[model samples]
Target: MDKLEGKLHKLEFYISLLLQMVDDTKYPFFKLVIENQLSEEEVTEVIELCKQTEIDFYVQKEQGWVIYEDLLAQFVGQLNSKLPVNQVIKSLYDQEMYSELMGEFLSIIAKHN
Candidate 1:
């Protein structure tokens, strides 16, 4: 089933991300991701998948990456069902940093399940 495969792919993508940096020594595990030594301990398999793109981009470009505009738009549309996610997403949108490394995340999901 396409849906099942898609979900699996998503899980795989997140896993790849978590296997990277699993520890940050700055933030106290309750603050923004920026205030610390980048790590992945706090990230979950699901959330990690969403951040795969960012991880890859940082390695390849040494710069931040953004998800495709169309994809980001679609994600936002889907986020409407969750008010809390929508709020955070909106904040990122306002900052023009909405992609937040999601492109690599999608790419990883498309790779292997």
Candidate 2:
């Protein structure tokens, strides 16, 4: 495949992984959140992170898709350093903006598929 095709393939793989993580409840963090095992402070922090992520996404989106993806990856990396992967995913899944983010990703996949 050519460069653009290769990039799209990589992005598609990443998106699919993200979708799976969001849907799967097997992770300990998912179970903990569901069982109300997290402290109120922990829940508040996750929610704050999710809101910040959403805002950052929209800001980067205006710059263009490539920049958006780059910044998003960096932002998620930062989040991963502070939170478990499953917690980050769960927090993002709970956001009102999650569907909109997924819709954008799905449309991109549809175009390439």
Candidate 3:
């Protein structure tokens, strides 16, 4: 496959993996996949490609909660597939901004059916 084709194939595969992860009961294994398989550049591309339609779904329900919006942006900002999401969660917690709600949002995105 060509470069773009290769990228698209990987993207589709990862997206499917993410969907499967939502229903997966194993947190540790899910974290491993997120850390190892999901690349920042690739996820970034996915975000950019989906941003228009994605609409930060969680934010809309709250009539656009500013904090959630900021958190969402930050989380997406650091989408290095090599990095585990816990790192971002830790940073947010250290900054006194992390919340279950934020985690829920990320979970929703990752596992949104």
TM-score of each model, paired residue for residue: 0.24, 0.43, 0.27
TM-score of 2: 0.43
lDDT string for model 1 (1-113, tens) is: 99999999998687657645544332223223333223454334324434553454555555543435444444445432323443334333333342544433335445544
- C-alpha lDDT score of every prediction, in listed order: 0.43, 0.54, 0.51
| Candidate 1 residue runs with Cα over 4 Å from true position | 1-46, 53-67, 77-80, 84-86, 90-113
Better of 1 and 2 by TM-score: 2
How far residue 22's Cα lies from its native spot in candidate 2, in Å, is 16
In the range 11-95, model 2's lDDT, one tens digit per residue, is 8688657656665444544544544445667766655765676677777677665434454454456553435554445444444
Candidate that would win on TM-score: 2
lDDT ranking, high to low? 2, 3, 1
Superior candidate under lDDT, 1 versus 2: 2
Q: For residues 1-113, what per-residue lDDT tens digits would candidate 3 score against the true structure?
A: 59999999999898778766664333433344464566666655534533432345445546844444445565566555455555544433333332454455555556544
Lowest-lDDT window of 10 residues in candidate 1?
A: 25-34
Counted clashes in each candidate structure: 7, 0, 4
TM-score of 1: 0.24
